[model samples]
Target: MDALQSSLLHQSALSYAYPLYRNLLDNSIVFLYHGPITPDLVVDILSLVENRLDDTGEDRRISKKLFNIMVESFSLGEDVERGHAVLLVRQLPYLYTVAIGRRIASSAVYQVKAFLDWVNTLSPEALREAYQRQLEKDDPRNLSLVGGVPAISILDLARKSHGILNYNFEYLNDSDTFFSLEARLQKTI
Candidate 1:
């Protein structure tokens, strides 16, 4: 490869990367991770987010809530065996958005969507009640073995985020569907 060819290749790579960089910047994305989600990675991500929040002088209360939401969101990726997952945190004018995406078995798509729809319909009080019931029913010791994590975590997420959970499913193929879940936390001044 000559110098000109090398330069062209570098420019080609930059051509693809610059747009993605701008998109992330324009969208106010503060953090992004796309790959397998593991416990260590979750801790590192949370630490980075915590540092960023502290640096920005974010409220302690809101920081705690955001941490909890991130934990639950990242846990969703633990079960993905066939595809990678995506986690992104975006800072907007009035709210913080935490979004997680993972590919799930096509057969589970309908059930997951229906469950999210039902959870989204509940009032805050009802969500609290549901969370309490799930907490009581779930055995902490067995949570990991059951299914990577339990639905109780989702309930907890809904309760903390004030029931503001958003989700979508993108059809990937006959065997898999990409599911994305997002929760928004309002910034209090």
Candidate 2:
């Protein structure tokens, strides 16, 4: 239902809950639910629902409502079925782009810092490798960018979207150090 609803979900209090939804989407800590939901099945269902969506500007309020409602109702279901509830919660990342689509990530050092800050909360090694791998397969010179990295690149994918990222902004200035961002990320996120 989370994925299906995110086929577009946005609007007011529902949006207020998107941060909580995103936190649940974080991969570091898991709920450890007991049930029949295999991770593969959750991924498959989420991809199916997400694939059916178009790239227009509209967002999914219905999905947000269902997600919010599920947070309450799913816990009430039998323990054996709780895994499916957990699976649904896992889909919130799929809806993140929709929730934050309009926010400006304009050319700001803090924007990259902000992005890296968010990445710091998750597994940094995983996030770094994911983008590096994507960049290896494409030519990034033609893409719309924020700090030279594609603003909405496929690297930002939440395991639900299917798009090829064709950019690589790994070229850091001479003054930039490997530990620079990582140091700040560790401190904040």
TM-score for all predictions?
Answer: 0.86, 0.20
Give residue 150's error in model 1 in angstroms: 3.4
lDDT of 1 at 88: 93
**Model 2 local distance difference test score:** 0.35
* lDDT (0 to 1) per candidate: 0.81, 0.35
Winning model by TM-score: 1
lDDT tens digits by residue: candidate 1, 113-178: 777888899998899897788777777786522122357767777877885689888998988888
Q: After superposition, how far is residue 151 of candidate 2 from its true place, in Å?
A: 8.3
Give the backbone clash total of model 1: 0
Which model scores highest in lDDT?
1
